[model samples]
Target chain A: MYKVKVYVTLKESVIDPAGAAATKEFKNSDYPEVEQVRVGKYIELTIGDTSKNVEEAVHDMCKNLLVNTEVEDYRFEIEEAAAK
Target chain B: MYKVKVYVTLKESVIDPAGAAATKEFKNSDYPEVEQVRVGKYIELTIGDTSKNVEEAVHDMCKNLLVNTEVEDYRFEIEEAAAK
Candidate 1:
């Protein structure tokens, strides 16, 4: 089995309103050191099958379902895991 | 500056409707191997000033603003970076 962790994040060129708001909020609060903030999605998957190429399958999943390519960029890491 | 990556995830006992739906969709689609899916928040922050304790500040941020402690678990990592 494979345990995969995927991160889908806004592109640097895309303005992140949520991040901006969070930054403002941080500044207003005690965290003035927080200069920039970017929020993204972290997806974890437990793939039961190991016969297929895990990386290829995960890449396809990201492209097809998890990520919006226009405004977001994504990356993933895979690790072998004991079946659960 | 410091580059901080925070991962906020639902507790194992909590139900994840979105993740369950995604898993169902994957089973119906090409990724039948996907047995389980868990979705979480990936937050990135660039802390400009390094004078204060970065980890302590981040912990406070997560506790006060970034995470809902009741149903979620949060962890963060910090790396020193060239001023940006």
Candidate 2:
């Protein structure tokens, strides 16, 4: 089996309200040192098969469909293991 | 300044459609080894001040507004430095 890890984040230039809120709260509550906050996503997947062909297929899927390349970035890893 | 890291994920029982789709794509593309995909979010924040009171405030902000405790988990660290 293989494991795939994906990370997603907003474009750096984009305004992150959630992050902003966190920053504001931090400052207001006395944590004035907080400079900025950025939020993103992470994904992990376990695959069933352990073969080069299978890994290639999974990579393509992540590039074309699983990730929104326009705004998100992702990376994946593969591992071999006995079926579970 | 302080750094806050937040991780948000679907509850174990919750279904993740995005993860499912990624899995299906992996299998269909010939990467059948992919077993599953679980996606989550991550956040990082940098704070400006380095004081015990400030750290406490930032921690509370993260707990109360930065993260959805029901579906998210978070941790933070504090650092001392000259203002930049």
Candidate 3:
């Protein structure tokens, strides 16, 4: 089995209002050094078998399902899982 | 400046509905090898200065604000930023 982790982050040109709000809240509380904050999505998946080309399948998923290319960028890492 | 990335994931015991839904959808569509799925939060923060102990502060933020210890596990990576 292969364990895959996909990270989807906003593009450099995009503005993250939610992250801005969180930063504002944090700065108001106790963390003033936090200059900028951006929130992204992390996805973890377990591939049941090696039947398919795992990397290619994961890349396809990221490009089509997991990411909004116009505003977000995504990358993934796949590793062999220890048997369970 | 320091660039910090915090990845928050669901604990082993916790059930992830969103991830399950996605996995089911994927399996139904074209990816049958997807066995399990989990969704998590990825936070990117740019710390403005070096006055603070970056590691300590990041850990504190993760413990107190970013992660809910009950159902989520979190980890962070911090690296010095190149002057831009």
Candidate 4:
């Protein structure tokens, strides 16, 4: 089994209103030191068993549905998942 | 400056409907090998100069606003950010 960690964020060229809002909120609060904030989706998947290469499988997943490639950028990492 | 990477995940006991829906979609699609999918929020923050410890500052941010302690769990990593 493999544990896949995916991070999906809006492309730099795109403006992130949600991220901007969060940053403003943080700055207004006690954390004025926070200069910038970006928000995105984090996905974790547990692959039971597979003959295909883990990297390839994850890449396919990301490209297909995990990310909106046109406006979002995604990256993933695979780790040996512990047995249940 | 510091770059903080945060991962917010729903507690294991919490049911993730979105994740379930995505998993079903993947199974119906070309990637049946995807057994289970879980989804959550990913946040990246850039912290400017501060006299306080980075860890403490980040922990405060997480506790105060980042992670919803009621149903979510969060963890963060800090790295020296490159100068812009």
* DockQ winner: 4
Model 2 CA lDDT for position B57 = 74
List iRMS (one decimal) for every candidate.
1.0, 2.4, 0.9, 0.9
DockQ, candidate no. 1 = 0.86
lDDT of 3: 0.88
User: Using alpha carbons, what is the TM-score of model 4?
Assistant: 0.95
Q: Model 4, DockQ value? A: 0.88
Clashing pairs in 1: none
Task: Evaluate model 2 with DockQ and give the value.
Answer: 0.58
DockQ of each: 0.86, 0.58, 0.85, 0.88
Which whole-number lDDT from 0 to 100 does residue A33 have in model 3?
A: 86
Q: Candidates sorted by lDDT, descending order?
A: 1, 4, 3, 2
TM-score (all chains, Cα) for each model: 0.97, 0.66, 0.94, 0.95
Candidate 4 lDDT tens digits, B1-38: 99999999999999999999999998898778788899
Clashes of each: 0, 16, 0, 0
Write the residue-wise lDDT of candidate 4 on A1-84 in tens digits.
888999999998999998999999998999999999999999998887778888987888899888999999999889987768
Best to worst by TM-score, what's the order?
A: 1, 4, 3, 2
Q: Could you tell me the fnat of model 2?
A: 0.87
Q: Which candidate comes out best when scored by TM-score?
A: 1
3 or 4: which has the higher lDDT?
A: 4
- DockQ-based class of model 1: high
